[model samples]
Structure formats: structure tokens, C-alpha cells
Target: MSLQAPPRLLQLAGQSLLRDEAVAIPAVKELPRELFPQLFMEAFTKRQRKVLTAMVQAWPFICLPLGSLMLTPELETLRAVLDGLDVLLAQKVRPSGWKLQVLDLREVDENFWSVWSGAPVSSSLAMSQRQTGEDCPCTGRQGCLKVVVDFCFGFPDIVLQEFLMHVCEWAQQRKELVHLCCKQLVLSVRYVNEVRKFLEMMDLNCIQDIEVHTYREMDSLEQFLPYLIQMKNVRKIMFRHFPGCIYCSPRIGAEIMWELISTFRKLDKLQKLHLDMVNFFKNHLQQLVRFLKNPLVSFTITGCWISESQMDRLFLSPSIHQLKELDLTGTILSDFNPEPFQILLEEVAATLEVLILEDCWITDSQLNVILPALSRCHQIISFNFCGNQISKSVLENLLRHTVRLERLNSVIFPVPLECYGDNFDHIYWERFVQLRAWLMEILRETQALRKPEVILLCTLPCLTCGSRASYDLEPSPCSCGKLGREP
Candidate 1:
């Protein structure tokens, strides 16, 4: 029988792998015999003992079964113990300065969710059952596979928080990567640097997943990126940042990070790239746009827009024709003239399988031009158009054209409101009703798409009002003040 190392697990906790000294492990190794008798137990041989010793010493924490539980007569039991230990070491210990990697979750839940849920699920509705109380019908007898309810509100809670650094060693033996979550990362900037160095270490090769999320800037990232650029197995990378991420200011931001990201070209095996801000994206707009236009298995852009030059380069890239998933939200397409964007759809609309346009400046004419071309993207399964101008005629026609579109996301128009010049409170309810009727009339020709498959998310009496003119297309949060409907 052939033996294979375990797969990489996602690093979530939001703690930098290098900066968290408590977790930044030097290479795996054995402690002096005088220190731990737990490994000297007769059940563990020289190899098994070597692996066990490394786990606890590698990191400050880990999650595992009780200490003496594996003192058994079974070889299978011993193997399970050793493999888990090996994975633990792999995640924490690394060589000097060569391999930093990151991975994701789809690899972990392979068929595990089936065992957990006890039934096969295909539809979105079927998979979205997080409610509790009743025994899961999928598991006729077992109920839910795993259920632990505790109000531990923070980190090390969702993941292993105890001092069992031993768990890392156990994972190393099996040749698997450990897992971490992003939300668990709640720390100051000073410590995030530690994660960078730990990841930069060499021995920590063959990784599966690691995510480092920061609110403002990833200043420490520049140092270790060159090492990560060498990982032969890095397939997916997801970066989440908050607000403008001012680190990305005009020419300087992109000019600096461009060199760092250039290392990404080393991962000839990469399939996914998820970026979270519009600012940093602006720097590498042209190259980033071209990179996205390729055979990427999945692409998602939330609240980001393309630059003028990048939009021009997009037309030249043949990769734009092979994308599988695409998502864009709160994008400012109007900043530049909408012509290049229009030219873009004319070429790639037929190849797009998934499209999301929310809070964008989409005119009815643009939608009309793209409709026939889009009908050919037969694989389209998800379409989210929340708050954009869709001509009543095109919208009605879209419903019919979306045959393979499994999830046809309907629209949420800006709520109707009347502007009361001086006294904002005196704004009457009748004014809104009248405006609502008028807006509906604007799309009256295509109001027939309110059926079951199309999810129509509606919100009215919203404090956020609409534009006085027909041009402004910006997002406004719900401003529901203390004023209630007039009695």
C-alpha cells in the first residue's frame, strides 16, 4: 500500500503565523528524555516517539484527544496517533527562509459534510439548513454528526485553544496540514509580523492553506512574499482588508505591491485569487485586470472597480473567455467613460458563467446590448443584480433567456422618497407612495419576473432616499431615523 501525506488545512484565527511567537514554532524536534515521559511510553517506538516529541514543542497550542488515551494494543490506533502528530508539526515548523503557503476549505469538507449531515444535498435551499432542535432527517438515527454548543465568544475557541501543541506533531506524522479560521484573528499590528516570519521559514513546505487578514495595511507582507512565490502547491489565495486600505494611494500603493504580487507568477498551479479592496486593486489595475481575464477556475470581486488602462488591456487578454465564476459589487464603473466597459461585455458576455453587478452604474441600454450576447453563457448558474438600472423590457426578457441560470437573483431598487427642501421630517408618506408608483411605471413593461425561482429582496420606507436626477448611482445605507409612519 502507498502512503501519502495529509492535505493542507486553512489557517483562520486572524493571528499572523510569524508574529504569534507563542505559535511560531522552530523546526520540529524531541525534548530531552528528562522532560516528557508521555513520549517514552512503550506504546511509542523510536519513530513514533520522535514525531510525538515535535508536536508539543513546535507550537504553543493544539487540539487533540486526552494524553494517555492511546496507550492501546492496536497498530491502527498507533498510526492514527502518529499521522495526526505529523500534520501538527508540518503546519508550525519550517525550513530557514523558503516556503510560505496558504490553502482553503473545499479540500477539507470533501465528503466529510455528507457524514456530518447524513444525507446528500444538491440545492442551495437544501444545503442552507442551519436551524436546530429536530433530528436531522438526513441522519435518520444519528441526528447531527457533531454538536457542541458553548458560548466561548472568541479565538482559540472555534479552533484549538488549549496547550496541546502536541496536535501539530500528530498532523505532521500523517503528512497533513492543520486548519485555522480568519475570524479567530483578533490582535494588534505588532504581533502580525510574527506570522510573517514563521511562514517565511523553509521546512514548512507542502502547505494547503493560510489566510492573513488585516484592517489597514499588510506592511510585513513584503518580506515573506518572495518565499511564498516559491511554493509549488499554493492553489488559492484570499485576502480580506477593510475600508480604503489607504496603503493603496494612487501610484505609490500599486508600484510597491506590484513587485510583491509578481512573485505570484511562480505558482504555476494556482487556480483562485480573491482580493477584497478597490484601492490596492487600483495600483495593479492593468496587470491585475489581465491576470483575472485568464483561465482562473473562480474569480470574485466585491466592491472593486477597474482602471482606465486596465480596462483597455482587458480586451487583449484571451483568458477573459474562460472564467467560471465572477462577482463584482459596489463597483464604480462610471468614474471612467462606460465605453470600454461596454466594449468588454460585447466580447466576453457569451463566455461568462456567473455574473454579479450590484450598486453599479448599469444603464438600461447597456443591459439591452449585453442580453443577447449573455444568453449564450449557458453555464450561468448565479446572477445577482441588486440595485442597478434594468430597463423594464430587458428585465422581463432576461427572465426568459436565463434558462440554465439555476439562481436568477432579482433586483432591489433604491427605495422611493420625496425631498422636503427645509424640513426633512415633514416628508410625507404619500410622497413615497407616489414615487414608488412612478418608479414601478418606469419598469412596468417587465414586472413579470416576481416568481418563485427569482428571489426578489424588497425594502421600502427606507430612510435612504433616491437621486433627484436620473444619473447618480451610489449606495446609501438605510437611514431609518426615529420618525415613524404618520398616524
Candidate 2:
């Protein structure tokens, strides 16, 4: 059979029969290793206690996703899953380069953590290597295999505890290599104490990347700052604030924002930093400016409230001049002065290759003030300024300024206000047609230098779906001639 066809096909065929429990129970051993992952999923969903236990013992590789089992209120299925996993850990013979790796502990909540952390391990759980060197299964050198665990909070207490203890036991066996190999840790801020406990249990110094997502309002970040600061070698950091149950409540204070930035300053090897839905105060802008002094390759700040005065210092900073990709989408600056933004554009004209400022409320006056500097952004390859109040003539002039930008390749503009809003019976079709002509003209003019990807979306939000949807306007006689919002 191996000679005639590939093992993957045979594996898929055998697992197809496993859907019928009676047939699978009899032919389980005949299933190939390639079908192991699929069988685990089926057993988990079907609650086939025996099959789940059997597959765990037969699993070829070491990485196990304990969380995928979806710990139910009943512990019977959970016990079967864990017991089968123990057998693999205690196996007498193993593959040459094999060692336990990558245990996923996601959706772990407070209740789950409480039960497992202090639970006693069975003496029978000890593996052959710990008992004697006679039938030692692991031949891989110490520190050869790295273990990465994906942890997310909000699991019930008992389940989370069991998951943590499992990780702790595994780490104990490979004490020397475990920390060196562990790479990334992600935390969601629903329960701060739970996050702290998990961090305390793990070796933070060895981790390379940390991502923290916030859903609730945290009054102070004192508990997380210290452990994060200790991870000096961490290279990438991401902080995103998600709207919580209080839909209208603010996310964080200015002081907290500065403190977060200050925490980032402690890491010398930081390369990429992403902050979303964060508010910035004028006083806190200095901390952000200082953090940018490092030669960062990518900087993204979205849904932030930055005044025109603050934008002035941020854009002219020496750090902005070195960035390769700069994204400032959803940062409201149109309500303030435009001179500062124009100056900042001039400073980054030579270095920035990608610029995104969607939904920033940029108007004709603002575009006019920056047209001279915008033309100098010759290196920009991708540009997006959609969801702003730009008129047809102003946009045409804007294109004329950027026509000579040989490197420019992608552009997405907002529909001019003249053609936006609710207009039935193709009232603005002529204006829309004129806009399309201008776009085609630009393409024809720049055909030799750069063929840019240009997209212009309808300015009005869809009355039905609440999303922007462009209309297919025909030349008055076609079916699309009647294109308009449905009543």
C-alpha cells in the first residue's frame, strides 16, 4: 500500500471511517500517524473517552494542545485526555530528536488556575527516564527542544490550575532547556491577578515577545510593569485596548499611557511596537517622542487622539525620519491646525515608503497646505487617505502633485463630498463619471513610470450594512443607471 500511494491519502481514508464509532474502535491501530491530529479533534468533539486516550499515547510529535479539548463541566473527559498524555510522557522508546514541546493553554480563567496549581501529581506519572537510565526514551540533548505555550485568561478556576500544573511538571523535567526555548507569551486583561500569577510561574527572562490586550479599564499597571521590564531581550511588543462592556467609557488615562510608553523605553532591543485605541495627551507626547529615538523599523498607532500641536513634535522628531512604514490611521488631527502636519510631512518625505491616514478628517485646506510636501514623498509606495472631505478639483490637484512620484504604486481615496450622501435616480452619475475619467487620465499619464493601484470608495456609509459600498454607475441607459440605496 505504501508503494502504490502516499500515506496522507490512506490516513485520510482511514479517519473517514472513524466517524462511525463501532468501526473505528476495531480498526484504531490501523490508522496512520498523519491521521492523529484529525482523530484527536473528532474524539474531543464526540467525547469518545477511549479513543482520545488511545490517540494521545500514539501521538508521534510532542506538542500537545490541551486547551482544544474544551474542558467541560464534567471532568471524566478531561481525566481521560490527561491520562493518555501521561502515557506518552512515560513511554520507554521515543523518536531520536523528539522531546515534549508547544503546549497550548488558551482560555484559561481564574477558576481553572486555582484547582491545578496546588494539585498533587500521581507517583505513577513519573516517566522511565526519571526512574532509571535503562530504557531511557529521550536521546535529544538538553536545551535541544524548545517549549512554547499560548496562554489566554478567562477559564474557570479548576481548569486553569490543572493546565498550569501540567506546564510546571513538564518544565521541571527539562529544567535546563525549557526556559531557553520558550519564545512568546500573550495575555488578555480580564483578570489582572491571574495574569500576574501566570507570569510569576513562568521564566519571563527567556521570552522574546509579549502581547497584552485590554478589555477592562485598568486603574494602574503597577503589577505588570515590573515583570515586563525584566524581559530585557524582548524584541516585539503589542498593546491593544478593546472596548469592554461599558461601551461609552474611556480606555485609559494619559498618565497610564505615558507609563506604558516608559515601560517600553526600558527595552533596548525593541524593534516593532503597535498601540491601538490609545489616547495621547500633550504632556505624554514627550515620552512617545523619546521612545521613538530608537531606530524602529515599523511604528503603528491607530484610533489615537492626537492634537495638531502634539502631531507637530511627533512628526518632526528625528525618529520619524528613519521609519520605513508609518501608520497613523484614525488619529483625529483635522479639527486642529494643519501647519504642523504639513511640516511633519516634509520631514519624513525622503524616508517613508508607506503612509496611512484613513478617517483622519483631512480636508481641502489641509491637503492644500501639504501639497508641496506631499509631492516630495517620492519614496511612498502605498498611500491611503480615505474617509476625508476632499473635493474633486482638490483631489485632481493632489494627483498632479504626486504624478511624478515614480515609486508610488497604491492609492485609495475617499469619494468627493459632491458625489457622496443620499442621492437617488443617479443624480450624481455625471460627476462620478467625470471622477472616473480623471482617474483614467492619471493612469494613462503615469503608464510609463508606475502603474498604481487606485481605489475610490463611496463616501456615504451604507444605510443597510453600515459599510462603505461603491455603486456601479452605468451610462444612464444601462440597468445600473437606476443604482441607488434601497428604501
Candidate 3:
């Protein structure tokens, strides 16, 4: 074992100063700029409220990432930091070397701390410049201090909820001097009124990502869209568990769908869109695609049925031509024609990095239609077709095609039909082992530039234990299968 090194002279001196707040508070202004971060980190960690407040008042840096040091939310620590700002604001003459403009309360700036702890100072300066780039709302605004925080409404954490509420109230009280910048906002429809009021209080233009989770009536979304439309800088939007408008009249449902699709036109910077269990967009996909003004990098639609025409319209949309990630997990397509989807694959082959079609129920013939296009996706990194039924011959053909994808690293395919009995309950483990071995041999024979790390053959979940059996280089059976029980 190696002996640990003792603390540096500067660290020991700072600790001694912190032991007496009366001396430390007065010494903060006279202390060297380089010692602030290290000393502040120690003071924050020890919850020395007065020292932290004094350090914040004399902070020399342009951005202080206090949130990074907060491993867990502490109301006293947060209140201490805010109270320092309150003191700083009331001062008639700002302290010399007072460059603090952004107090970021987001969980970031780990690099800032590392660089301050002995790394070159220029590297820390460069990171600070990057963090406070031109996009920063308070970048050159005189006497305006921007406080950045990520608000997650309707979360179950009581302490965090209280902390956020206090921050909101403080920001509201000093609106003229402070700009509350929220880049990411998550809203649960259960607290619709609270979220609405929160959005109204903050600057919406600073928001870049927004997610809405709804388990109630569709009107919750209808009520929330006005606020969403104002977030012009939002790059990603996700709607999860958005209920269908079955309780309303058909005409009223159509109106709500129209309102929802029309709101996308205002989000010119949107690059990623995800809709899960949102059934209202079944026939309105074409209208939605028409409103998207920019190309999308990621698109995900799960557990939503689409008709043949809607599928064709989706593939034909120009916005999806540059997609890097596409996930259609649980979107049934066994009966739909595959020609339109084939065109989409061909269109996005150059840029597509991830493709997931798990539980889509695609047939062998449909897979054949897209195999040529799939083979050309040279940039593909991950591919999943789990829960689809295919014969051994077709699976072999699929593997042969995938061997050409040099960048592919993961491949998850369903076990071939030959390894199963009349139903998925009766899995032929011996046959599965044989087929997996054969497939491995075939992969070895192909000799691609890069082989996938995960080449798994998955089966349906065991009826008894609800565990799935997967065959890779070795077979892993579920508990029921290992016990020779009927599952």
C-alpha cells in the first residue's frame, strides 16, 4: 500500500481561515482569485453558511456552478447562496474584480472544478467562455445576473420541490435584476396549473428541451400547447402517455388534433420529436409532417397505429431524410406494405446511426423488402429486430447483409421459428443452441471489418417467471426453463 500525501499549504491555510468565520468573511475580498473555487468548494461541502455567503459576494469568476457541488439538495446551502446574491445586489458600489454574471444551478461544470484544482488556469477560462457563449441570455447585459436551473414539475422528491419553489419565489421578487434561465423543463399534467404559472413566470425563449407527461384527459395538452408554442428555441419535444380524446365528440377531437399539429409550425428549431402512446395522431401524421419546417435528427413513435397512407406520407416527408436515429418499437406493421418504409431506409442510410424496430411484428417478406436499404447504412451503430418472426434461412440472409455494415456494434434479433414449437411457450433449447452455433460460424466466415459486440438471439418472455432467454456466445435460460418446468 502507498502512503497518502498531505494537504498543500494553501489548502491547510484555507481550512484554518474557514474555522473562524469572523476572520474568513473579512479575508474573502483580499484572498487571491485562484483560491476562491478551492476554498468555496470546502466551505460548501462543510455547509459553512456564512463563509459561503461571503465567498459568493466576492466571487471573481463570471460563472459559479454551485449546483455541481450540491450532491444532494440542501435548503440551507441554497438559501445561503441566494442570500449572498441578495447582499451583493444591495451594495451601493460593486466589489472590485466582481465578474460574476451567471450563477448556474444546473448539475454541470465538473470540469471547472477539476481545472481549478491544479490544472492550467487558461483551460478553465476557455471552458467558462464556452459556457457563457453568445447564446447565453445574460451575456453582455449590464447589471443583470442570470440564474440557470432545470425545473422538473410534478416529481415525487419533496425536498427538491421545496428548493425549486423557493428559487422561483426569489426570482420572481427580483425579476428586474435577475433573469431566470431554464434550458430543460419537464411537466406532468397532474400539476397543469402550477406548470402553467411557472412557465409564465420564467423566460420561455431560453428553453431548449421540453417534455410533457399526461395521464388525464386530452384537454390537459390542449391547455398546455399555448405555453409550448412560446418556447421558440426548443430543440426537442416529447409527449408521453398522452391519452386519446375518446371522452369528447369526434368533431371536438379533430379540433384538438388540429390544434396540436398546428403548434409544431412555431418550433422552427425542433430537431427531435417523440410521441409515445399518442393515438390521436393515427391519421394526422401527414398534416404534422407538413408543418415541420426543419430537418429532424431523431424521430420516435411507439404504440401508435398508422394506416398505409399515413406510413407512405411519413416516409415521403423531406424532414426525415437526414434522420440519425429512428425508433419504431411496438408500432405494429405486419399487414402494412413495406415499400414506403424501404424508401425511407434508403433515404436515411447515409446519416442513420441507430435503428430500433423491436416488437414491430415484421414478417420475413417485409424484412426482405428493406434488407437492401438496411445493408447500405454504413454509419449504423445499433440495430434491433427483437420479437419478429423469421425463418432460419431469412435470418442467415439478414446476417449476411448486416456483415457489410462496418460501424455496426450491436445486433439483437429474434430466435428463428425453427427453434420454437406450435407456440412461444415451447422453446427448443437444443435446436436454439445448434442454430446459434451455426450463425456464429457464418459470422466468422463473413470476416467483416468490425463485428458486433452483442449478437443476441432473444425469445419471448417466459410465461411462468416473465424472464427472457437469450442466446449469445453462450445460452442463458430463464428460471423456468432451467428447472424443466412447462412455460
Top-TM-score structure, candidate number: 3
Ranking 1 against 2 by lDDT, winner: 2
Give lDDT tens digits, candidate 2, residues 1-487. Answer: 3566444554456458666877776565566655555566656667888777766555554555454345533456656755665665565565453434434333332222222222344442322122111111232544333344455444356865565556656556655544423346666655667656566666665566677666655653545777778877677777676445444225467666777778778788777666676552334554564674376656777877766666777766665566667787777767767777677678778787988877788889888998898888889888887767788888878767776787877777666777654552233656777777877787688677655655444443444444554532322122332333332
Total backbone collisions, model 2? 17
The TM-score, computed over Cα atoms with residue i paired to residue i, of candidate 3 is 0.88
Candidate 3, residues 339-403: lDDT per residue as tens digits?
98999999999999999998898999999999999999999999998888888999999999987
Global lDDT of each candidate = 0.41, 0.60, 0.82
lDDT of 2: 0.60
Query: Which candidate's lDDT is highest?
Result: 3
TM-scores for all candidates? 0.52, 0.68, 0.88
> lDDT of candidate 1?
0.41
Q: Write the per-residue lDDT of candidate 1 for residues 1-487, one digit (tens) a residue.
A: 9996542221121123323324423323323322222332221333343334344333222112222233322334344444433453444444332111211111222222232223464543421232221321222332111111111111233232221123223323332233321111122222345434333322323433434344444554554465456555555666555333455423335544676557665566566666655355554645754543235665555666566576556544554545666666666554445555555555555555567766666666666666666666655656755556444445555545554343444333322223222333333446544544554454454455432243332222324443221111222223443232332
lDDT of 2 at 311: 71
Question: What's the CA error at residue 234 for candidate 2, in Å?
Answer: 3.5
Off by over 4 Å in 3: 1-14, 114-130, 137-140, 242-252, 464-467, 474-487
What lDDT, from 0 to 1, does candidate 3 have?
0.82
Ranking by lDDT: 3, 2, 1
Candidate 3, pairs of clashing residues? none
